[model samples]
Target chain A: MSLIDIQRISRLYQMGTETIHALRDVTLQIQRGEYLAIMGPSGSGKSTLMNILGCLDTPSGGKFVLNNSDVSVMDDNALSEIRNREIGFVFQSFNLLARSTALQNVELPMIYAGVPKSERHKRAMDALSAVGLADRVHHRPNELSGGQRQRVAVARALVNRPSILLADEPTGNLDSKTGVEILALFEELATKGNTIIVVTHEEEVAQHSRRIVRLRDGLVAADEILHKNGAAAPETPVFPPIHASAHAGPPPVPPGAH
Target chain B: MNLSELIENCGMALRAVATHKLRSMLTLLGVVIGVFSIIVVMTAIRVLQDSIETSLSQFGKDVLVIQRNPAISFGGPEVWEKIKRRKRLTPDLGELIREKASLVKSVGMQNGLFSGEVTSPYGKTEPSFSLLSLTPDGFPAKTLSIVSGRALNSSDEENGRLVCVIGSKTAEALFPNSSPLGETIKMDGISYLVIGVLESKGAMLDNSQDSVVIIPLSTGMNRYGRSPWGLTILVQARSQETYNDAMEEVRGILRTARKVPPGEADDFEIFTNDSLIEQFRSITFAVRVGAALISSIALITAGIGIMNIMLVSVTERTREIGIRRAIGAKKRNIMTQFITEAIFLCQVGGIVGIALGIAGGNAAAYFFNVPPVVPVDWAIIGFLVCAAVGVIFGTYPAYKAAQLDPVEALRYE
Candidate 1:
């Protein structure tokens, strides 16, 4: 079975007296280990679809299955549990707890998942190391650079080992070079058999992913899988691996490859 | 939640509280004052109660006293008028009770004079010691025991001897080097030979109970006009079993001796050690209630202040809440976090208030020369009350934060 199954999902919002159809009869399926991006203009209902997929909201009408559990009929508490255990979310802004150290921020999801302290510490350390932040674990978000902060947020998102790594405009705040570096990190994570989903309006950010699901007017506009050997995976990453800690003062320029 | 999770939540809440120190302190000001007012008053009352207990314990449960006035003035001038118009008790009434009441163990009369200085050949004391004259049985009635020399005998009363008994402390002050027995002590230039020294008791309130001088009752009556000031009749029951009967018999004897008509209020006030505690309670009841009322009003105002600050916090942290929700925190998790923060604020204020209140209250105890009191019960109650106030006031804003739509909250500027 697919890791996620959504059939004819619909979401509606009531504003004043008008009913806004954020998502109307949308169907999608995502298999494990798929690296995909959802793209749309504002009001194109991509945000609604991402909300439904992330289990932050229940669809008004749908048959939704995640990890073989029926998510469409779950209550708020159950949905929260599903979100904690099955989804990892990265946002446009780093969204780190301002007061916590990098390790503490990364451990936040497992805290909600009721992970034991010692184990949570070990796992948080491992997650930070995976994001090349082993030396920066004790630093707070404000103390870290923009790239390092986003890296802490990503480590936090992936720390729980969730079924999907979902990011919304994950690099919208970064410079183009730093954005490309984050995309490379995503590509690396996806190559390691993690199911990664990126939602963005930027074509360049979407091009880094293997598959693209385009949304327009609360419906799927197009779904296409680009050939990785041909264009998706370049000879050299369009942006090379950049660890903020290794180059704090100035990031070394990467050779452009398209 | 489990202990570990609760601990984590509490730590996070504390951090949030620490992040905005001035805001949290300002918000908790009312709570601090509320807890302080009640705790200080309660601590002082607690000290008063202990002082009274220590002092009154000199009189056993079987001992009773008949006097012209209550142990304390409880009410307005009307109560004073009622007491003032009553018949005065005299040494003769004690004699009547001794003669007629079968349950009466012993009756003694005391005529207390103004406090005065005493001087011996060796030294002189401060003008702070009490002087009283007692009949022979007054010793047993008051549970006073002789530590040295001998107690005054009936001859001392009948012959109106110029012999006197001094308290251990008074003896110490009067003759520091030599024995007070067979020594001449002068009160207001009237010299009397010390015949006995009473045992020492614990310090009651400010002055030690041991700083007292006693002479014969007949001598006191002869020297000071007996009827104008009145006398206190002390009665001791034969045993614990006859204590109530002894009190009743004495009431009947006094009524007959004074010719009080049936069904009329007795013209004298009867009290015991236990009754002193009761009077103390009545004396403090109004102050306690007033303090509680003012503190409660202050706490309610503080609670509203907490609600206002928390609401502002929720609005300010909307995006943070959305991020937490998206990061897998449930609605209740968010709710718990915010409530913990509010409670953390209140507890901080309460702890400070309790410390200040204890210090303030103990300052009064110091003036009274009473032992310092902790008032642990009041401290615990104050802590719990602050927590309750936190919960009562914190729920609404927390609920509002929890109910916020994650999509919108994340998008909130």
Candidate 2:
């Protein structure tokens, strides 16, 4: 069974007299240990899909099964619990608390999880060290560089050992060199059996992931699979829509795949 | 929720407060002044009460004193005029209590009428010194003892002998080198032999307790003209258990002796040590109420100031709240943190006020020449009230912060 099972989810917003459809019956599935990227332009419902997947918001319609539990109808408190335990989100802004040290920011999630002090401290240190920021644990966000702050955000996301590491526009604010470093870090995490989902409008960031799911106008446009030994992914705008179903998943169609 | 988490939240709150040093200090100054105002007044009153208690205790616990006017009176000159209409308690009332009241251990009469210079062949005393005429039992009733010579006797009172007892101050003044016993002293051109020297009782209510001479009551009545209200009578009980019984006996005797019929109030007033203390509390009632009014208004205003600053803090940290909520913080967590910060400010300010109040109170004690008191009850009350102030003013802003939507707050500038 897939780790995440989404069956035709929909989201709607009412602005005064008009009903705005953010997402309309969007269907998707994600397997364990998959490094996937969801890419689309602004207002293409990419952000809405990310919010639903991360459990920050519940869909207005359809079912969301995370770890075999239907979370679509859960209340706010239950959703908060799921967000804390099952999803780790890294935002584009690297939202570290300005007054807290890097280690304290990293320990924040486990605090709500009611982790003991000694264990929380040890896990926070280990997570910071994992992101190559061991020496900067005591430094606050204002003192760290943009790249370092992003790493701190990643450490905070991973500290609670969530099921999926979901990042929204993860490298949008970083320079190319630092962006490459973060993408490489994600690649290494994926190789170590950690599921990652990066949502971005930048094709360069999507190229680093193994699978790319492209959305256009609140609907899936293409699903691409990059071969393991391929030199690079194809730079193409047009691809046949491979609408994966619940019974029968996506078929192998890329010519570069073995 | 847990100790460690509470500490972590406190650490965050402290950091936030430290970052805005000037704002927090000025904000808490209101609390300081509020707590300080009441604490200072209460503490000073505590000191004054302590000194008054020390002085009033000299009258002894098992004694009931009858006088024409109450010891401490208020309510303006009308009260004084009403008090003046009451008949004077003459020496005959003391004699009646001594003879007829079986519960009383002794009855002592005093007439503090004359204050004149007592001249000896060696030296003379200041004219400000007092001369008290007393019966034989007045020495024990007033807690006086003769350190060198003997006190007045019944023979001296009945025979109206020309004998006097000098206090330690008068002894030292009239006879610097020679013994005051057997020395001749003249008061108002009347010669009397100094038969005894009284012990020096240091002071009472800023008055010198030792600068007085004692003569027999008969001698005083004869030499100085006796008036109707010149005598004050004291009746002592055998033990603490019979104090009320003795007071009833004396009251019944005086009422009948002064022709106070049934269903009529006694013509004279009676006072005891406890009654004096009770009167003092009522005397300070207005001052206490005024202080409470002013301090409560100050504290409420201070609470408003606390609410104001806390609201500003919540608004400023909107993004921070977003980050925390996005991480994992529940609504209650945000609320707890902000309330803890407000309470911390109140307590910090309250502690400073308590310290200043104690210092100010002791300064008053020093001025009154009484032993200093800390008034720990006021300090504890100040602390609890500060916490209440914090909880009262801190909750709304914390609720506001906690109610913010994570999505909208994240996008806030």
Q: List, residue by residue over B1-413, the lDDT tens digit for candidate 1.
A: 75666887788878878888899889889999999999999999988888778777766678998888777675798888888788777777778888888988888888787588999989988898888888989888777899999998999999888889999889989999999999999996678899999988754443456888899998877777767375888899899888888888888888888888999988888888888888899889999999989999999999999999999999999998988888888899999888888898889999989999999999878877789999999999999999999999999999999999887888888
Q: TM-score of every model?
A: 0.91, 0.84
TM-score of chain B of 1: 0.94
Of candidate 1 chain B, the 10-residue stretch with the lowest lDDT total is B200-209
Tens digits of per-residue lDDT for model 2, B1-96: 777668888898789889999999999998898888888888888888888777666566777878887877767988788877877777877888
Candidate 2 per-residue lDDT over residues A12-106, each given as its tens digit: 98899998767766777788788889987777788889988987778999899998999998876777778788888898999888889999999
Model 2 DockQ vs. reference: 0.46
Candidate 1 fnat reads 0.64
Q: List candidate 2 stretches off by more than 4 Å.
A: A228-258, B84-89, B110-135, B139-232, B239-241, B258-267
Q: Which segments of model 1 are wrong by more than 4 Å?
A: A16-19, A230-258, B204-207, B228-230
lDDT of every predicted structure (CA atoms): 0.85, 0.84
Residue B68 of candidate 2: its Cα lDDT? 86
Complex DockQ per candidate: 0.52, 0.46
- Tens-place lDDT digits, model 1, residues A169-217: 9999999888888998898898888889999999999988887887765
> What is the TM-score, restricted to chain A, for candidate 2?
0.89
